[model samples]
Target: MPVFLTIETTCDETAAALVTDQLEVLASVVASQDKLHQQYGGVVPEIASRAHVERILPVIHETVQRAGISLADIDAVAVAYTPGLAGSLLVGVTAAKTLALALGKPLIGINHLQAHIYACRMAAGRDVFPCVGLVISGGHTCLYRCRDPLDFELLGTTIDDAAGEAFDKVAVMLGLPYPGGPSIQKAAEKGDPHKYAFPRALLDDPNTLDFSFSGLKTAVRYAITGPGRHDPSQVKLSDQEVADLAASFQEAVVDCLVGKSFRALEITGFHRLCVGGGVAANKRLRTRLEEEAARRNVDLVIAPLKLCTDNAVMGAIAVEKWKAGVFDDLYLDAEPGVVRRSSALIHG
Candidate 1:
């Protein structure tokens, strides 16, 4: 069994893992800088990049050690290369390339979004193709039709604000801590979702799979800053106001994602729905997805919490590619944008 060493630095977390072709996760490690970025209320590209540089080597070393494997035992190095901050992606890509070249192993480039989708396989332990994938996070909000592990079709994506981005913005408006999704989710548990009714975007049209959350973000801004506007510093949102706003905001995002995902399942006639990315870890979102998916004929697969963010174990996704002899040279470059690829829809 070939072991693939994977590195993921597509965002604030620098991670590495070792996995076998059978998808057994030997060891996975993540070094998170959430606390470091919290003071800024969001991730600073420079700070994230520097954090990756410092964390990448030690994390990979420990991952291999924990797995009781040597670097020479791995067959390939897979790294998430696209659809993330350029600086952050570079740190992982550069590290992976360095290790691959030094160790004489083949290097594979994995898509960040694809890694997020395939993270389900780690927990599900089986092929979940012909499934609808909804990836919602601070960086992305997209839906795809998956026929297999590697094959994916882009049905729709966010036009402006991603679901997670809206969460952070709304959280800032409500004076929540940084990395707002979790903070908001926690606060909302004590609040009522219907206390403030927020707009639901793109629910009317079946043909339109695209999403827009900027207006809802704007609505929150106006609600806090007051219409016809006062300085943001002029008014402080009460704690109740913040909680209600958070509940309403979280509800709006979850409703849009869950609704559109099922609609896509209906359109594609897929029997399974898979969700991942940072936002998928939300308890409310997961509950709604499970309940809704059960109501339909579709099966629901949610990635484990640790793997939901940019964790390297998702690179177990590279096993099929390794078996198929897919590898790259050390001269690989990071592609930091939503990629359109044909081979993405095939899973197993």
Candidate 2:
């Protein structure tokens, strides 16, 4: 089997993995910048990019060492090139291009969002196509009608803030820790999800599949500090108040995600649903999805918790392209922003 080295520096995580032609992961390593950006309440693009530059090489070396193989054994190189922080993507793409040039091997460019959905296939240990793929993360919240591992048509997307981004901002409002998903989930466990009736924007609009979390985020803000110009830092919230707010806010986000996911399935008539990304690790969201899927008789595949966060293991999607003989030239560049497909292209 040909060995491939895959790099994933799309955001705050510096990651690399060694995989075989058969999708077997020999080794995977990720260097997280959570602590570095924790104080800022969210990721700072410049800081994330700089950290990736510093850690990408070491991460690749560690992955290779763990795999018990040297660079000579690798047959190809792959790196995520699109839908990411510009500087972060450039670091990985530059490194992969350099390695491919030096080793005389083909280079493959992976789409970061597509790779997230592919994580479900990795977890299933089987092909999971012709499904509705929902990717919820700090930077993305969109749905795709996935015809195969490589073919994805955009179904719907967020009009404002992504779900995970809202979580981070709300966490800051409630004095919770950064990387808000996990922190908010933990805090929400002890509170009533119905304590406050947070708005679920666009949920009532069955005609469209778009999501809107900005209003919900603002509602949480007003709940914390009345709809006035008061600093959130000065507002003292008791432990119970924080927990209740977290619970209510989380419920609102989950409602929007679940409602939209099922709507996509209904629209596409796909029996299977695959979900991945960082916020997919939320316990409440996972349980709710499981319940809903079971009730609707939908085949649901969620990436394992370990695979839910940004990591190179999911970049194994590159293997599919490699097998199809799809390769990228050295001119491959990073696309910092997401490019959405027109609604007219959506398949029923």
Overall lDDT per candidate, in order of appearance: 0.85, 0.93
Question: Candidate 1's residue-wise lDDT over 180-220, tens digit each?
Answer: 99999988987779987778878766667778899888877
Q: Worst ten-residue run, lDDT, model 1?
A: 339-348
Query: What is the clash count for each candidate, in the order shown?
Result: 12, 0
TM-score of each: 0.95, 0.98
TM-score of model 1 vs. true structure: 0.95
The most accurate candidate by TM-score is 2
| lDDT (10s digit) by residue, model 2, range 29-78 | 99999999999999999999999988988999999999999998999999
lDDT of 2 at 58: 92
Give every collision pair in model 2: none
